[model samples]
Each structure stands twice: as C-alpha cells, then as structure tokens.
Target: MVHPNTTPAQLSSILRKCAAASVLGSGKQAHRHALVSGLIPHSTLETDLLLMYARCGRLLIARQVFDRMPHRPLHSWNILLSSYAQSSLFHHSLALLHPLLASGLRPDHFTLPSLLKASAGLDHGRTGAALHALAVEMALNVHLIVSGCIVDMYLKCGWLVDARKMFEEMPEKDGVVWNAMVTGFTKAGLLAEAFNLFQKSQFEAGDADWMALPSVLSACSQSGDLRKGKEVHGRAIRCLVLESDAVLSNSLIDMYSKCGFLDASLHLFSRMRVRNLVTWSILISGYGMHGRGKEALRLYEEMRREGLEPNSVLFTSVLSSCSHSGLIDEGRAAFVSINRVYGLEPSVEHYACMVDLLGRHGRFVEALEFIGRMEMEPAGSIWGALLGACAVHQNVEVGEIAARKLFELEPGNPSNCVALCSIYERAGNWDGVAEMRRKMRDLVAVKTPGCSWIEVNGERLCFYQGDVSSPSSKLMLQALRGLLG
Candidate 1:
C-alpha cells in the first residue's frame, strides 16, 4: 500500500526505477499503490506507468494505460512506438502514427526513427520514403539520428542507389553513417563497392572505424580475396585495433579459414587472449570446411572440457563436418549428444546435416526412416539435402520423392527441378527428363546460372554459366575443354 504521505514525485521515481530494472511485479505493485492513493488521473504517474509496462515488454498493459490517459503527450506516444519497434512489432508500431497524428500531435525527430526502423523491419520501402518526406517537411531530416535512420532504412530495403544518394548528400557523415553504407554494400554482395568505401572512409577519416572492419573482412571472405584480407589484417594491427576487439579477431579467423589457410586460422585462434563460443565455432567450422571431421570433433570436445556449452550453431558445424567427411557414426553420436548430453534440441539445420550424411552414403532406407521420426516438420533444407544426395547417388526413386516435397514447399526454387532432371538423365530416363523440363517451363522456374569468382592482380572477376562477354572467354573455354578431355 502507498504511504499516506507519499508524493506523486516519489511514485514517479519508483516507477522509473522499476522500468529501468524491468521489475514488472514491483511496477504493478506501484501502479496499484498509485490507484489506491487517489493518483489514478495523475498525468505524470500514468505516463510513468505506461513507460514501465512498455519497457517490461507488457505492451498490452502499456496500451491500456495509454488509452486511459485523458491527455496523451507526444513523449508517451514515442515511448510506446519505440517499444513496439524494438520488439519487432512493426505493424503495431506503424499503427500508432495514425492515432498520434489524429490527436493533433506532430512526429518529432524522436518519432521518425522508430517508425523508419519499423518500416525497415517490414521491408516497407514506400512507408519509409513517406516518413522521410514527413521528416523533411518537419525540418527534422537534418537531425543526425533521423538522417542515419533514413539511410539505414533505404539500405535495408535494398534501395542501395537511394541510400548512396542520401549518404552522399548528408552534410556531415559520422562513423555510424559510414559503417551503415559499408555494411549494407557487404550484405548486398557488392564486396568491391564495400571495400572501396572502406578505403575511402580510411582516407577521409585518417583511420578506419573499428565498426566497419568486420564487414570488410566478411567481403574478403566471400570473394576469397586473401590479398585484400591480408591488407585489412595488417591495417588492423597497425592501427592497434585488433588488440582489444574479439569480434574483429574472430572475423580474421573466418577470413583466413575461408581463404584456405587453416593453419593461419588456428595460429590466430591460439594466440587470442579471449575466446567465446563463436570463436571456437568458427575454428571448428573451418576444420569441417577442410573435411577434417575428426579435428572438428576433437576441438568440440576441447571446448567442452574448457567448460563452454555448445549451442545449436556449434552442433550444426559439427554435424556438417561429419557429413562432408562421411563419418556417419560420428554424426550420429554428435546428433544424439545434442539432446542427451547438452540438453539442446536439434534445429532444422542439424536435421538437414544428418539427412545429408545418411543420403550421401547411399543409406536411403535409414535416411527415410530418420525423416519419418523427425519431431518437427522437416524444412526445405532437409528435403533439399536428401534431393542433392539423390542426384549424387543417381537414385531416381528417392529423388522423385524428395523433389515432389520440395516442389510443394518451395515452388519458386528451380534447383530442385533441375536436380531431378539431372537424376533422370544419369539414369537414362529420357521420358522423365522431358517431363521435368516441361514442368519447369510450365512453372516458369528458371534456375539461376552457376557463377564463380576469382581474384587476380588485386581485382575480382566473376564468371557465370555460358558467360562469354570477357575478352579471354574463348581461350579460357578452350583451355577448360582441354582440361576436361
């Protein structure tokens, strides 16, 4: 019960503390005290209660409190909107804008960011653009935080050209803005553009922001640009940036591993002063990538010995390593350990890895049985793995079953149709191949052509299937044919 002499100021203070600490039970009690103390209609108290509930993730109760407020302030609306956006309730967050504007309250710099974030979360570029226009009209677009959100929303919605325009037009670019564009380019698979921006950032700022380094390393890893990767690593060292950043170090380990320098990855892993589960997972996955399942398993055990619990991600790597090496027994043991030893339920990825392992070894019967016993509905990856294995083993019967399920689950994926056609061709079933091609044409399921990238003379070149646009294409194709012959 609230003390007889307790002031509204004290109650507000108590509610603020509850919100900060996420003490929902205490916050509820305080709400009760305020109601009993005849503070039910207190504006400050009600807003605090709303904020408390929102911060505690009790959005329904927060909305209830907000509805009861006779005079809702713009600050209260922002709190609720931000809460919804942060919780990824994008629709609910956007819904608040209509009521907020209808109530004659205009959105401020604080309001647009949350709404823009919600737009980004929903991939609603049009909604985000409208918010940008609103910000411009309100003269709030020039605000640093609001401008950053605008750029981020555009980038996340895949409007890279627009994002670049906004980024270039910004009168002042902070580290956050620079990192957003670089990271956006990296995620969009424009690695060269990402690296070029990274270089420009370094030149303009006189030092690379530690935040953008990971994205650059990721680009290097994706493109297999070991030369650029080494340049980045050396720059990190020279800037003394890698000394204190575990994330940056982990990215380096991943880069070296992807570049086929397993020893260098291990050496970096060993010298690290701190190692998280992700660090261990990266190294184990690197070993797995090199088809060293035994080494990966050994590291798994070592990580366990050091008292680090393995999560689903680590188990996926372990299972993948076993699949690649065809270590069925080891894969079984590791799959069983996920639930029995570690008390972690197997994810769809672990199930997919198991299917791949069994199907690759021509154990179709056991693989079918395994799928039958799955606790959850098998996802496309699981069936795709089985389908891929069918193509490898040239098993037309099992391939048909897997492909049918894939067609239903992923109608847009042409790879499954293509795989079945390949299986039919290998089995000398011309009729089946013709039927598959007809189905592909009917569904309009066009397969994306295979592409490969190589780095030479500090430049990355890409070659797609049947691509002859390059000057050296004819000679390269002749050389490739000779090698095949």
Candidate 2:
C-alpha cells in the first residue's frame, strides 16, 4: 500500500492531512510509504512524517523515526516534543528536553507549548513554574497562543493561583486564551466561575467561537442547566459550529442527555452528518447513563457493523451499559471480547464494570472470585461497587468485608459508612447501625454537604443541603406544605 512513486511534497501533503484529521491508520500507512520511497531524511518531509505519527498517537514509531534522523533541526525536536506531549508520555517527553537544548537548537514558540504540555500532563508544579519563568524570560509568553499554554500549564499543575495570576497579567486575551481558562475552570469544578466568565466574555467579545461552547456546554451539563444549554445550542447553530465539528456535536449530545432531554440528544445524533468513534461513544454513554442498556448494546453492534473498531473506551461504555441494565450475560460477553477479540487488556475500569455487572445480579461470591482472578489490583471502585451491591441486597457479611477494604483505601470517605449503615438497617441489625455511626464519629469523618444548582432567567441559582437562609425559604416551605396538603 506504500505509494512509492509519490513525491516527497505530495507525501507531505498526505501526512499533514492525516495529522489534522487524526486518521491514525492512514497516517501509519503514509509513514510506511515515506519509508519505502527511500526518502532519506534529515529533511522537512521526514519531520512532517514524524509529526504525523506523533499526532496520530503512534509514539513508539515517532521515536523510532526521531532516532533515525541523522541531523535533526530545531523543528524536528519540537515535533518530537509535541508527539510525546500529545501521547501523554510526559516523563519520556521531559527526558528529551535537555538533550534537545544540548544540541544547540534554540527553543521557539512551538517548543514552549510542548514542554508546557508535558509539565501539565505530569502535574509537575515546580517544573511548570520554571517553564513559565523561562517563557517570560525568553519572551515566548508574548506570543498570545503560548500565553494560553502557560495558563493551561499552571492549571494542570493544580496551581490555580499561579494560573489566575498569569491570566490576569497577560497583556493580551484572545479567544484561545479565554477558552483555555474556561476549560480549566470547568475542570476544576468552578462551573459558576466558568459560566460567569463565559457570559462576560460573550458580552465583550461580540460573538462566541466553537471552542467556547464545549466548556460552557459542559458547565451547563454538569450544573443541569437545560436553559443555558439551549442558549449555547442556538449559538452553535448561528455560528454554523455544529455543521463540521464532530466533537462539539458530541458534547451537545452529552449536554442534552445529562439535562434529561433524551429526545433532543437522539435527534441531534440522528442528524449528525459524520459520526466518528467519539460520537458513537458519547451516544452510547448517554444511553447507558439513562439506564437504556439494551439500546446502548444495540448501538454498539451497529457501530461494529459499520466497520469501526471498538477501542477500550467504547468497550467500557458497552460494559457499563450492560451493568446498568442488569444484562449480566451480555456484560460478561463484552468483557471477554475486550481481551479475546480486541486484544486490548482490560483496564481497571473494565474490570470494575464486570464486577458491578456480577454484583448487581446478586452474584457476590462470583464477583469476589473474579476480583481475585484479576491481573491488576482491585481498586477502590471495584470494592465500592461490591459494597453498593451489598447494601442493595442487604448482604451484611459481604458488605462488612467490602467496607473494611474500602475504609483502608478511602479512609476519610463517609459514603462507605453510609452504605454500611444502610445495609445494617436493611438487615435488621440496629446495633450494627449504631456501631457504624459511632465509628464514623470516632474517625471524625465529616461528610461534605451536597449542593445543587438550577438555571432560571439565564442565571445559576445555587442551593445547599440544609440551607434555609435564602430569601425564598418561607415561600419554599409554604409551597412544600401546600403540595403535601
């Protein structure tokens, strides 16, 4: 399949398209084509090929290409940095920084982003701070895009104060920078802040770009703001953002689903012109979330019939779907296929899904045996799922075992205590329930109060557990009494 007769320029064009589209298989074929064409490189074509492999998530191949380069220019080093950064191989990427500088190739705007990204991925606060200082010293931060990267680096390192300071000090604020801050704020669970900033930016910036909608929509989704989500959906329509952007479309579907608007989600999904793996994943997850497990399984089979291979994430969604719908047999089959057919080793998530599937079916002993057989350690989630199952079925003995492990794994979490108490109550063990409460008090395990928000008149109205100090408290009480009456 190697196009040997293709010119280097033509091959470069193909690779660039592959990189941009993220068509991994085609990109690998092009890399092979470049190799077969005897395109000896220390040249631009090879550099582009290196970038294609890296961007396509083929880091090992990208490293091989990088190692073979007889004379790599600064651009090549930058590409390698980006490849490692893109693959989330932060440690490996950081290892190359010194050798790259040692070769006497100066870092440029492109180089800074990759290095910052590696620091962000690793959550290396010290390294990220040093990178920020270097960016400032080298005048790289003056580049508006690199400035955004710096903000992102700080946020990823959990240095929220530093990130905010950097953002405030930046002389320029473009859409990209604003979007980065929005994304970071959303990731940090500061949805109210993200929403406020998003609204503020919309007022000042005139019109929103496609990048703004995702984080904003995500905030809307997490906050259960169907009203604001609809507003963003309208903006996406007006901007023609939904026409060509699969990612934004998927986010829209997720937002709709989380807001309990299944009809809207399915409608948009049906209307999408192009559906990629992510699109399928989102839709499948949406169905699973809503407990439409059979529908999710149907969609999975349909995806396979279309010749799209299921990745581990897609498998996770399918297994989760089975778990939610109580399709134990189906879940087991899908879990087995993950390793047998797809050859992808089951991750902890997949194993957790299988355990939940069995546990939900009252197969506690089988679930524990399965956990014992797992190649990897049974994580907190695995045991937690078992604990939840015990509470549901009031299996006091198994629940106690799960609670012990969960307590060791997550010592401070009150949910496990709550679960044990509920199981004890259901099993008619009053003393056991009292003992659990006493244990919680002894451990000083103060539970975090739950809170929720709703959008009304285009604003998020916050409420908290046991809160009665709001102006509407009297009205709320009256309404509840009237409803009960």
Candidate 3:
C-alpha cells in the first residue's frame, strides 16, 4: 500500500524500482496507487507505468496504459516499439510506425533501430531498405547506432552486398559494427571472409575485441580448422580476455570438440575456475557427437551432483548420446525422467531421439507404440528420424508409413522422397523408385547437394558434390586413394 502523502516523484521512483526488478505485481500496485492519488493525468507517472508493464512483458497492459495516456511523448512510443521488437513480435512492431506517423510524430534515431530490428527478424528486406532510406532522409544515418542496425538488418535479411556496402561506407567503425559484419559472414558459412574481416579488424583497431573472437572460433569449428581454432585461442589468451569471459571460453571448448580434439576440450574444461550449464552441455554434446555416450552420461551425472538442475537442452543432449550409442534402455529412462524426475516436459526433439533409438535397432513395433503414447502430436523431425532408421534397416513397410507422414507434414522436403526411394531400391522395387521420382518432379523438390570444407595452408576450401573444378581436386583424390590403399 502506498502512503497517503506519497508525491508523484516518490511514486515514479517506486515504479522504476518495480521495472528494474521486473516485479509486475508491485508495478501494478504502484499503478493503482497513482490512480488513487489522482495522478492519472501526470505525463511522467503515466509513462513510468507504461514502461514498468512493458519491461515486465505485460505488453497488453502497457498498450492499454499508453492508449489512456493524456499525452504520449516520443519516449513512450519508443519504449512500446522497442518492447514489441525485443519480444520478437515483428509484425506488431511494424504496425505501430503508421500510427506514429499519423500522429504527426517523425521517427528519430531511436525509433528506426527498433523498426530495423523488427524488419531483420521478419527477414523483410524491402521494409528494412525503406527504413534505411528514411534514416538517410532525416540525416540520422550518420549516427553510429543507426548505421550499425542497418548493416545488421541487411546482413540478417541475406542482403550481403548491401550490408558490405554500408559497412565499407561507415565513417567510423566500432566494435559493435565490426562484430556485426564478422558474425554475419560466419553465420552465412563464409568462414574465409569472416576470418579475413577478423584479421582486418585487428589490423585497424590494434587488437581484436573479445566479442568478435567467438564468431571466428565458431567458423573454425564449423570448418574443422583445428589450426585456426588454436590460433584464436592463443590470441584470446594474449589479449587476456579468455579468462574473464565464460561465453568465449565456451566457444573455445565447442571449437576444440568439433575439430576432433576431445582431450584438448576436456583439458580446457578442467582448468576453468567457473563453469555454467552451457559449459557442461557443450562438453556432453561433444562426447555424444564423437560416439562416447558412456563418458557423456558420466559428465551429465557429475553436472547434476554439482546442484545445477538440467534443462530441456541438456536432456536432449543426453538422449541423443544414448541414441547414438544404442543404449535404448538408458534412453527410455532418461525420457521418462524428463517429466517425472525433473518436471520438464519432453519436447519434440526428445520424442524424435527416442524414436530414432528404437527404430535404429529394428524395433518397429515398439517405436510405433511409443509414438502412439506421445503426449503431443509428432512433428516432421520425429517422422524424419523414423524414415532415416527405416532406410538403414531396409524396412519397406514402416519406411513408407514414415515417408507418407513426412510428405503430408513437410511436402517441400526432398530428403523424405529420397529416403523412401532408397528403401524401395534396397527391396528391389524398381517400380516404386520410378514412381517416387515422378512425385519428386511434380513437387519440384530438389535435394540439396552435399558439401564439405577443408583447411589447407591457412586457407579454407569448400567442395560441393561433383565439384572438380579446383586445380588440386585430382591430386587430393589420388592422395586419398593412396591413403586407402
């Protein structure tokens, strides 16, 4: 309850505290107190109430407060817009700009960044370009924050050329801008370009910021460039940033694991002074990926003994480890424990892993029964897992069932058609294979070709199926044949 003599300033302070703590109940109480104290018409108090609700994720209540405001300042509009964007309600955020314009309020630098972020989330390149134009019109493009957001938006929307142009044209480049470009290239699977930019940032800035190193490490992990990964580790150590940042340390562990250096990953893990759930999760996943399920489970138990509760992601990793190692009984117990032992519902991923485990061992009847008992509807991943297992075991009848469900659920996925065709081929059903090909043609579903990356002499090379255009392809093939011989 608010004191009877509470002034507007005191009430505003209370609202800020509630917002900072994200205490929606306290925020609502403050709102009631403001109303009771006849402070409803005060602009500052009303705006504070709106911000409190917005920060607490009570967006509908915040909107109501905003609408009821006698005067909605530009700051209030920005808060609402940012709240919606941050919540990933992209369409709702975009819709608010129209009313703001209709109210004769021009968007300032703060407004455009949120809209740009919303555009990026929706992958709406046209909307993002329009916002960029508006920023230029208002001469706000010169602002570092606005320009960085534009670059990030363009990159996320897959407009790499535009993003690069904007990035190159920036008069001043800070760590935020550099990180955006480097991370974008890394995510786009252009590891060479990402590393090049990372090097360029070091040359220009005299040192690499701790932020960009994680993306570069991720690129190294994806390409299995152990040399590059170690180079980055050394650089992080020289910069004295690795020990201070858990996220960077996690990235290093992940890179080493993916690069087929489990011992190095474990050594780093043991040396860390503090370890979080993510750190444990990465190590467990690494063990699973390398087919060391027993070790993975041991580490998982160790994590539990440390008093940290397992989340859904950790459970998925554990189940996946069990599936890969053919520990069907262990997988089943883990699946049951997800709900009964931990009070966490088994997600679609957990169901898929269980199906894969049973189906992989040719237990079709048991797999089907398990599917029937699922609390939620089976998704495309579940069917896809069953179909993959069927192909492996040459189970034509169950393969067809899985493929049919996959076709209905994910019609555009050509992998399903391919899996069913493989099953038919294994069973000597030429007619079935031809008919499946006809369906694939009708659906225009073309399977993506396989690709691989290799690092040679500090350069990353990508190879696609039937791609022999590289000058060294013949030499590499001959070397591979010689090694096999």
Ten-residue region with minimum lDDT total, candidate 3: 202-211
Encode model 2's per-residue lDDT on 72-145: one tens digit a residue.
Answer: 98988988887778777789888998898789877899998888889988888898888788888888888977
Which structure among the candidates has the greatest TM-score?
A: 1
Model 3 Cα shift for residue 103 (angstroms): 2.9
State the lDDT at 175 in candidate 3.
86
Ranking by TM-score: 1, 3, 2
* Alpha carbon lDDT at 179, candidate 3: 88
Give the per-residue lDDT of model 3 (tens digit) for 1-485: 77888899999999999989999888888888888878788999988999999999999999999999878899999999999999999998999988998888889999999999999999999999999999999999999999999999999999999999999989988888898999999999998899889888886655645579999999999888888889889989988988888999999999999988999999999989899989999999899989899999999999999999899998988999888888888888999999999999899999999999999889998998999998899999999999999999999999999999999999888889999998999899999999999999998987888888766676657789888999988998999899999
Candidate 2 structure lDDT: 0.86
Model 1 clashing residue pairs (backbone): none
TM-score of 1: 0.92
lDDT of 1 by residue, 1-485 (tens): 55667788998998999999999998898888888878889888899999999989899999999999999889999999999999999999999888998999999999999999999999999999999999989999899999999999999999999899888878877778888988999999999999999888886656646678898999999988888899889888988978789999999999999999999999999989989999999999999988998999999999999999999999998999999898999999999999999899899999999999999999998999999999999999999999999999999999999999999999888889899999999999999999999988988887778789876777668899878999999999999999999
lDDT of each: 0.92, 0.86, 0.91
For each candidate in turn, the TM-score is: 0.92, 0.75, 0.88
| Cα deviation of 161, candidate 3, in Å | 2.2
The Cα error of candidate 1 at residue 444, in Å, is 2.2
